[model samples]
Target: MKKITTRLATMDDIDQLADMFDAYRQFYELAPDLALSRQFIRDRMLGSESVLILAEDEEGASAGFCQLYPTFCSLAAAPIYALYDLYVRPEARKLGAGRALLLAAEAHALRNGALRLDLTTAKTNLAAQSLYTALGWQRDDIFYAYSKTLAA
Candidate 1:
């Protein structure tokens, strides 16, 4: 079996990260927009608003990527990270790329003194939910999440 390696992503990784990000957005039924994706990832990296981790296969191919955004938890009065994205290429599935990326994100959060890491997946994404739970992430059954979109 090929080994997977995970690391913190740098600006130089924007191209690979953008490709994976575009694919991830497409997984949510969004249209493919590599240019926009590249810009978004580049902005995030340059702005230092998010922490990204990349996973590479034994051959150094882009296997997966995960991103974490730091935010304050009002109720808890503490710092936390929102794990906004995680994706593994189709050919990389079942090879532990996703799990590796997730673990790397968690480690980064912990090292940064984050209170906790939070994430939400589509309700129909059972595979992701399963992976999260199996990795000891508690499912929030206490509070219902609501979102409101404002006109731009």
Candidate 2:
């Protein structure tokens, strides 16, 4: 297994991060658009509204990334984070990069005094669910997620 290192993503990592993000979106059958991906990540990084962590191998190549958004839990009166995305390159899966990215995100949440972290994965992604379960993440049994597209 290769040694994996995780760190907060920087502007220098935008190109690789964008590519990985595009792949991640496509994994859910979304259309590919590098420019849109780049701009989305750029805005998040510049606005500081979210945190993006990148996993790299010993050779300094990007292996994976996880993006988290800060949110508040009004009822709990505490901070929370929504882990919107996590992805490891096909060649990097099972090499500890994904786990490293997850751990890194958990550490960031703890460091920021967040009370909890939440995420949703596709129902068909059993492998990812296994990983989340192994990492002590509980399956949400309380509520279902709903979304509606807004007019642009």
Candidate 3:
């Protein structure tokens, strides 16, 4: 495995990040639309709506990326981060990029005074569940997450 490095992404990284973002949506069964991917990532960066982390391999190729949204957990009464997206390129799997990205996200959250970092993965994504477990993330057995689609 090659060395994987992670850092907060800046506007200059939009191009590479958009490419991986497109793949990430495809991983979730969304139709591929490179233009849409670029615009969405650009909007986030422009609006400062989400914190983006970029991971790169030793040769400086895009390895993976993670997105975090700063929000507060009402029960905790403190700021927290929702780790909404985490994706490693197909070829980058098992190279430690995912782990590196998650670590970077946590460091960022802590530095910003967040109480904790939270994330949800598909029930069938066993690999991601395992990684979260190994990283000391505890599953919330007490609450069942539910959501309803709203009209756009």
lDDT of 3 by residue, 52-146 (tens): 99999889999999999999999989999999999999899999998999999999999999999999999999999999999999999999999
Q: Assess candidate 1 and give its TM-score to the true structure.
A: 0.96
Ranking by lDDT: 3, 2, 1
Give TM-scores for every candidate, taking all chains together and pairing residue i with residue i: 0.96, 0.97, 0.97
Distance from true location, Cα of 41 in model 3, Å: 0.7
The digit string of per-residue lDDT tens for model 2 on 1-152 reads 78999999999899999999999999999899999999999999999988999999999999999999999999999999999999999999999988899899999999999999999999999999999999999998999999998995
The collision pairs in model 3 are none
Q: What local lDDT score does residue 46 receive in model 2, on the 0 to 100 scale?
A: 93
Query: Where does model 2 exceed 4 Å of error?
Result: none
- Candidate 1 has its poorest 10 consecutive residues by lDDT at 97-106
Q: What is the lDDT of residue 64 in candidate 2?
A: 96
Segments in model 1 whose C-alpha atoms lie over 4 Å from true places? none
Query: lDDT of all the models against the reference?
Result: 0.93, 0.95, 0.95
Quote the lDDT for 25 in model 3: 96
